[model samples]
Target: MVALIATAFVQTGFAQHDHATHQTQSSALLPLYYNIKDALVVGNASLAAAKAGEFVEALKNADAKIVTGANRDGLLEHSGKIAGSKDLKSQREHFAGLSTDMIALAKGSKLSTEPVYQMYCPMKKTSWLSSEKTVKNPYYGSAMLTCGKVVETIK
Candidate 1:
């Protein structure tokens, strides 16, 4: 009985530690994600692709087991699409998908240490994530940099 109690205590401690680690890893991807977004906003497909690669690596390091189901697969698939394409238009297309999945993932995981803005462009009819309250259009770049509005803020 004493041994059983000790084992339970150890398991409980491990579970708490694992939860904290999971939170840290989940939140760690935001800055990388933002970097990718910024590159896209500047109409730099090559830079965006490079950042996407880094995002994918960070996702892998975050541990797939912690993010099971569609969220994990969607992130990997979309980020891969972004990384595999060099064309600015193609990158932005894939980025649309990536942002969709990321918004859901952020909501589900409760990631982002600060509020993440879900900004939407009326012309594109698509949304992207932002660390700030202001809109910086990733789809139109400087052609229409401030074309979007904050539709939602996830904290």
Candidate 2:
């Protein structure tokens, strides 16, 4: 009975460690996501595509337990679309979907140590995440720069 108890304790400890590790890995994806968003904000489709490709590689490297099901599928799908396209319009279109999934992921997980702002574009009717409170609308770039407002702050 004592041996069984020890085994159970060890198992519980390992489970907790796995969960903590998963959270850390999930948080690591934020920088990669931001890279793509920053590229879009600058109106650089090629850079955005390159960043999307890098984000995809980061996701692929993440532990399988970090993201699962629809979350994983959506991230891969949207980022892959952006990575494959060189056209700014096409990349931005895919970015909306990618941002949606990213927002969901950010909301569902403790993805950052600092507050993350969720900014909304009234014109595009879409939202994206940012490490800062100030909005640099990725949807419209400089055409309508500062077009969005901070809709939520994920702490």
Instruction: Estimate every model's Cα lDDT from 0 to 1.
Output: 0.88, 0.91
- Which segments of candidate 1 are over 4 A away from where they belong? 1-5
Candidate 2 has which clashing residue pairs, if any?
none
- Which residue pairs come into collision in candidate 1? none
TM-scores of all models? Answer: 0.91, 0.89
lDDT comparing candidate 2 with the true structure: 0.91
lDDT of 2 by residue, 1-155 (tens): 99999999999999999888888789988998999999999999999999999999888887876677888899999999999999999999999999999999898888999999999999999999999988898888999989989999998
Q: Give the candidate number with the greatest TM-score.
A: 1
Predicted candidate 1 versus true structure: per-residue lDDT over 35-119, tens digit per residue: 9899999999999999999989988888676666788788888888899889989888888888988888888877876788999
- Cα deviation at 102, candidate 2, in Å, is 0.7
Give candidate 2 misplaced runs (Cα > 4 Å). 1-13
